[model samples]
Target: MNLQTIGNAILIVLVIGWIGYRQTTWRPVAIGRMYRLALILAIVGAGLLVQQSHGLTGLDVAVLLVEIVISLGVGAWMGAIARFRPLDPPVRVGSSDQVARFASRTGWWGLALWLVVLAVRVGIDVLATSLGAHAATSTGIILLLIAANRVARTAVFAVRLERHAAVTA
Candidate 1:
């Protein structure tokens, strides 16, 4: 591989590492926090899309949407299986109620979904590149998939937590 390709490979590795680091640090999160994370991820995905060399073809967009759907489905299932606990009180003025979660290790499988998705992404990328495909073309799709997964997972956590609290109250 040339220097640029090598550099890109290194960047991808670093990004995966960063994502893994984030996953490991999960804890109780507030709604606002989760929303912000989702928003940020979405914006990043959009930015990546705009930077693409060619305008999105119908097939590209379609494939991206499909991937996003898959991401959301897996994310929701993963989120639903996670464990959550109330923060003693649902709310305290100016303090985080911790009802929403991006993702937490409190569940049975911990970061299984996150890790699995990440590994799958890397595998797909490697396979695509080996087949002489331009990987950058799919950057937007990849980012969107990541963003969608997090948002879906976060939404699931919020819904479940709210319902859980309601039932107990």
Candidate 2:
């Protein structure tokens, strides 16, 4: 593999490690932070998509769509299974002192779901490679898929947190 491939592999491992740590630990839910992360990932992924778009084929697009669906589905599933508890003294969010925060963790289930996603992603990549769809293997496309997944999870968390706040308020 070339340096770029090695770099991508390292980046994926680091991201997975970071995500795993976050999902298993009780952390304050900052909706703004989550959205910002999703946005950043999306922008970077979009840049990669543009750089690689010239070589895409119909099959690549189809495989990409499939991956996106799977990513979003798994992310939503992870979010739905996450456990949330209210913070003792509502934490301040941003510059507004009026915000209440909660702590959330997916625990072991989140890790398991992450493994499932990785397995499925690898499986799909192998299948797509056999079918000659290069996009399936592009790190940029992978990032985009991840971005989409994050957005789904963030949306679920936002909604659930809202409901939780209303009930606790």
Candidate 3:
């Protein structure tokens, strides 16, 4: 594989490892952090896309749209299935003074959903390659798909947290 492909593989592995660690633990729901990461990924992805867009075909764009939709759907499903509970005394997240009154964990179901996302992404990549949509398999597209997924999941968490706050207050 080329250097870009190898770098993409390494990045994916690291991200998957980090996500897997978070999935099994009851962690403070840091909505701000989630959004920030998503935004950063999106910005970087967009930059990469600009660098690569000249080579993209209409079919590549179509494949990307489909992958984005699937990513968002799976992310929302994972967020919906996550279990949330009140943090006993609440805890500060990151450097922000914003206290997290609730913690959430996804356990096995979230992991399974993530696996489904991975499978669907791989399947689409294969199909896209067969259809001559080379850009569909690019790192920029992969990052964008991941960003879309994270944004959807973060939105669900934010809405749920707001609802919970309303109910409690």
Candidate 4:
């Protein structure tokens, strides 16, 4: 991808992430749900992965959508697991040791699983870039913009969910 597209993608992800982080508390249910939503955003990003690729035919979009659905299913399952699993020990001892420990334990697994999904998205993006003879065209730029909007909207929703949960908790 060219600098412009890359910058746009980065802006999108960061905005969404920031929104989620700002809206949510550090509670497990809220944070876990937010991460789950992040996974969905990543799947959307994956769909846009082939936007600039010449090799991506109509069949490719179908395949990408299938992949997105699969990813969402798996991500939801994993998020449920993270939410229900028993908390583990913290990596450090401190005043807020309980919270730290809980986060550390949960974060390890959550981050690991999310990283794997993210890796797939990155791989697809790279493949698309490689296949494209030119930099991101108008279609690709539009796709990226759409992905950005989706991600940002999802993040805002997640933040709202988090806030609601926090109020209840």
Root-mean-square deviation (CA) per prediction: 4.0, 2.0, 1.4, 10.5
In candidate 1, what are the lDDT values of residues 81-164, reduced to their tens digit? 766644444344235544432235434343566667666666655655565545333555566776788788789877887787
- Which parts of model 2 have CA positions greater than 4 angstroms off? 93-100
Q: What is each predicted model's overall lDDT from 0 to 1? A: 0.63, 0.84, 0.85, 0.45
Candidate 2 clashes between residue pairs 3 or more apart in a chain or in different chains = none
Tell me the deviation in Å of residue 169 in model 4. 18
Clashes of each: 0, 0, 0, 1
Give the candidate number with the greatest TM-score: 3
Cα-based TM-score, every candidate: 0.71, 0.90, 0.92, 0.41
lDDT preference between candidates 2 and 3, better one? 3
lDDT top scorer: 3
The per-residue C-alpha lDDT of model 3 at residue 121 equals 82
User: For residues 1-169, what per-residue lDDT tens digits would candidate 2 score against the true structure?
Assistant: 7776687678778888888998899988887777787889889987887786677899998998998899899889888999998788878767645454688999989988888888888899889989998777777887887888888888999999888768878
The full ranking of all candidates by TM-score, starting with the best, is: 3, 2, 1, 4
Candidate 3 worst ten-residue window by lDDT? 8-17
In order of lDDT, best first, we have 3, 2, 1, 4
In model 1, which regions exceed 4 Å deviation?
Answer: 1-26, 89-108, 126-139
